[model samples]
Target: MADRPTGDTSLPPRAAEFLELRPLLFAIAYRVLGRVTEAEDVVQDTWLHYQDVTERPRSPKAYLSTVVTRLSINVLSSARVRREEYIGEWFPEPLLEDPYQEPERAAELADSVSTAALVLMERLSPLERAAFVLREVFGFDYAAIADTLGRSQSACRQLVVRARRHMARGRARFAADRRAQQELAARFFAAIADGDVDQLRDLLAADVQLVTDTGGNAPAPPRPIVGVENTVRVLASVLPELGRVGLRLEPQPINGEPGALARDREGNLVQAITLETGEGRIRTIRSVSNPDKLTHLGPVADPWQLARDYRESRRRQR
Candidate 1:
């Protein structure tokens, strides 16, 4: 038996064991589900079950991972329904910074949790997503992955192969250079804040696409805006309003990519924007203005209020 708690929430032996592996379990769940809240829930639930076990497992790491992955699979099953009803284009919740402890697998880990990768994973079934994350990203062997998913080793291998085929087109092609990403992001946001259309256009890919998620709670384009010209026009028009409301831009690492967090005059987060760059030009931009998503990041202001204020200010100017 584990030690009793002095308080109601004191750590038990199994709970302590699970807590030690919390980072790894979180990485697995987040990779599988792409939502922080859901991922955290899965980890917590795994700990709850871990406490009930009368027999100790030979390897707690594998046991906890299995529990987390299965729980995430269950969540993902229902999450897909909500996603289908989601307003506008839905994106994975941005991981503001790396939270896991495996520095050696940093590159691999980043690719697994990247905005593009998560979006691509949405096309895969929950089981395939689990198999891919376990086998490819976390380096789990076929037999272990099979046990985790309650499938045969051969079947798990097939799931990984199928997932790879589905993701081949969208898989990452660039090496992550944190310094380069930060420098480019700095220049990119500076151009936006300064309203330098030409500079912004220069930093963008010829066929860049911008996707914004406001969940119909705030004003945003109803669909993805594609093409360099369209994206530049849209950014030029919206960013000024953002700036007008005294929303400041700060560079931060989001989902392993250099990105910007937008805050209002009072320092409340209004939006988070992440860019994908290649050949020194931005190819993709994802922004989340959904208040529900921003709550976990920090205190968030109403995005629509800012837009409304921008309109009123512009009217007064006229």
Candidate 2:
């Protein structure tokens, strides 16, 4: 057992073990789900389920891994229903920043979070994705993967092979160099923020797409913006208004690529921006502004307080 933090909610032994392995579990869940929000939820659920178990395992890391993997598989199986009902295009929720412990190690991690890789993973069946992420990304052998997947080793191996073939066909291989990508992303945001349509156009791919998720709680364009020219125009038009609302953009990593976080006047996060790139140009811009999604990105304004404020503002307007 490890020493406990003062008033910590977790049992000392459990907390120490969980802290040691949480990052690895997060990595697995993120790859499997391709959505940071969903991945975190699965990890939390795994911890809860582990606490309920009466019997103790010899290796807590292995036991926790099994829990997260199984929970991810279950979530993926049921996710199709929700995906179908989602408004606009549904892209994976992006990460706020690179969580790698060392700057030198950013590249390898970035490759795993590339938009192309994530989109390709979405093409696979849940089982295939799980098998590939476990075996390829995390380096789990067929036997270990099979244990988590509840399949024979041979079956797991076949699943991974199929997933790899699918990815090879669909994804263009790109080298991961975080510094170069970040520099490009910085220029891209600056152009858009300045409403330089021509510059924005030059930075965007010919077939760029933009998707916004506002969750019907706020007014937003209801459809995806497609084509480079259209995307530029849309972004250029909106950039000014965002600033007017006390929102400023801060560069951050999203889904392993350079992204932007929108902060309020006091520097509270209100939105997250993720851009997908291909052939040295931006291919997609995804902005998540829905409060439900923003919570994971940063501390959000309290809902009850926001409602009260809105009511008071309405009264003042009258």
Candidate 3:
């Protein structure tokens, strides 16, 4: 009789190493793919590739890094094809909350995952994006990045430099004072909840736009709501009825900016809201309610502490 298939429980030592690196691998993949579901899929495919190799790698970090980089590169290459067919404007998948809030660390995480940065990255060639992210975001040295990309260190350096210049050209340099922004966001939410259209109008910038992502799965406004008056009127009309649906709103941080966490009466996290500020007025109001996008913001934690831990980890990794 054929030998019985060994369960994961009977896997060898390398399996344990793979398990240990899974979280880090997933993080890398998510940053590259911008979607949690796609990132998870890439990591699983990496694991399968690892399983197929009979020879064990001397350095699991190097092995896993190679697997993730190649997978990310492959995804990036294919993504361009699909993005061309995407409807309307394309934006990066927003992070619901900053998991690491130590100022420097949070900033680093924010820099890597921010909507602005991600959108800018879309303009780069896949190799350039990978090189820049690996070197700048993750602080991988030229030699390591070269090895991962099968290029010379000098070539990797040039790719990163080009990517940085491209990003600098496309990105807006706006610094957010979290406390002040949070206070404003709270007021914005309160205005909506109370049907204070005048307050909402005063708080919103004249050109303000509100984008809601329901993932084409739920009942959401058909098009993006634009202009302060239109946004306020639509929200004022809808929010009062949210109480009847058992949704509650709580203040939360989104992408290191002031935002809100919406939950059901049962206290399950349902959505994350972020406001963009310009010239002391809200320029944009973005609500991410697709359950898939809100997974990162489910249980809120202190942004400061999260930032601290993320910085420490990056320091140690370097």
Candidate 4:
């Protein structure tokens, strides 16, 4: 991931323009590509390429969005192949913080970068995803989206329509009450800490789904766990193990929704979880412990090693 610039207030006029739009550029790239590192790479590439344009554009935002969108589409093209060969269900890397949080369109922006929404986006063609993100997420009109994708305005509209249709097929009707989500999450975390199966079961919908992506050998099933009973069993089983392993989970906003982050005793991030709630119940739980995904948050402990340590601790107790 490109390191965000620090301690540099003395940028050239053009560079300053790029810096001002960096957040939007990164947001566009991330929402399209669904990967922080690749999005950051696109942002850096946009900056480098933008520096070479001697004549300033009439509109910097449009130009920057166009460049970053194209670069992200290119990255997503190659990324598709690896995703097909991935061992388990591939999830977009968890995003802890959104760089492009637009207050006026806050809910739309939040839902667009959401884990569930991003997962559905993976099914879309790169252009379709880009078009949808530009139009739906960022409020870009067809003309602007057309410029970004190098297509006619009508064609851009078509892409958005198709992408929206594809996404709607799998989209859940999530409750939009932020405060309700927070309150539920607080209770759910309390249940997890206590390993209270009944409360956990109560908080989850009857058909709640838990999808975990470790991306390697950690403590997660390769297949998804579905239903309240099955989810409760898995969650209850793992909750105690976390204590044994000296890992702690804290409720945090992840991807603009109520979620949790796990850390080891030494404060190294180990896992991230995003909760999707609806009708006052947790419907989907996304757990991503992938080391490659967690590195951006900071020092990522080796989950594989953590497993070994847990086993050793078990042996010592015996």
Q: How many steric overlaps are in each model, in order?
A: 0, 0, 7, 0
Q: For residues 58-122, what per-residue lDDT tens digits would candidate 4 score against the true structure?
A: 99999999999999999999999988877677777778888776788888889888898999999
- Where model 1 places Cα greater than 4 Å from the true spot, the runs are 1-12, 172-176
Q: Given candidate 4, what's the lDDT at residue 103? A: 85
The digit string of per-residue lDDT tens for model 3 on 109-220 reads 6657765567678888989988887888777888889999999998999999999899989765566665676678888888877778888889998888888765653345
* Minimal lDDT window, size 10, model 4: 1-10
The lDDT-based order of candidates, best leading, equals 4, 1, 2, 3
- How much RMSD separates candidate 4 from the native structure? 2.0
Task: Specify the highest-lDDT model's number.
Answer: 4
Model 2: residues >4 Å from true position, as ranges? Answer: 1-14, 35-37, 52-56, 98-105, 173-176, 215-218, 266-268, 299-318
Number of the candidate with higher TM-score, 2 or 3: 2
**Would you list the C-alpha lDDT of every candidate in the order shown?**
0.86, 0.74, 0.72, 0.87
TM-score of each candidate structure, all chains considered together: 0.93, 0.80, 0.74, 0.95
Considering only N, C-alpha and C atoms within 3 Å, which residue pairs clash in candidate 3? 100-306, 100-307, 101-303, 101-306, 101-307, 102-307, 102-308
Q: Write the per-residue lDDT of candidate 1 for residues 1-318, one digit (tens) a residue.
A: 433223335666666676678889999999999899889888778877887888999999998999999999999999999999988877888788656768797887887888888999999999999999998998999888989999999999999999999999776576667677778888998898789999999999898999898888777888889998999998898778767778888888889887889899999998888899887888899999889888888799888888888888778778
Can you write out model 2's per-residue Cα lDDT over 68-185, one digit (the tens) per residue? 9889988988986776676654556666553434356456566666655777788889899989888877677788888888999999989999998998898655554556677779
| Candidate 3 Cα RMSD (Å) | 11.6
For model 1, where is the 10-residue window of minimal lDDT?
A: 1-10
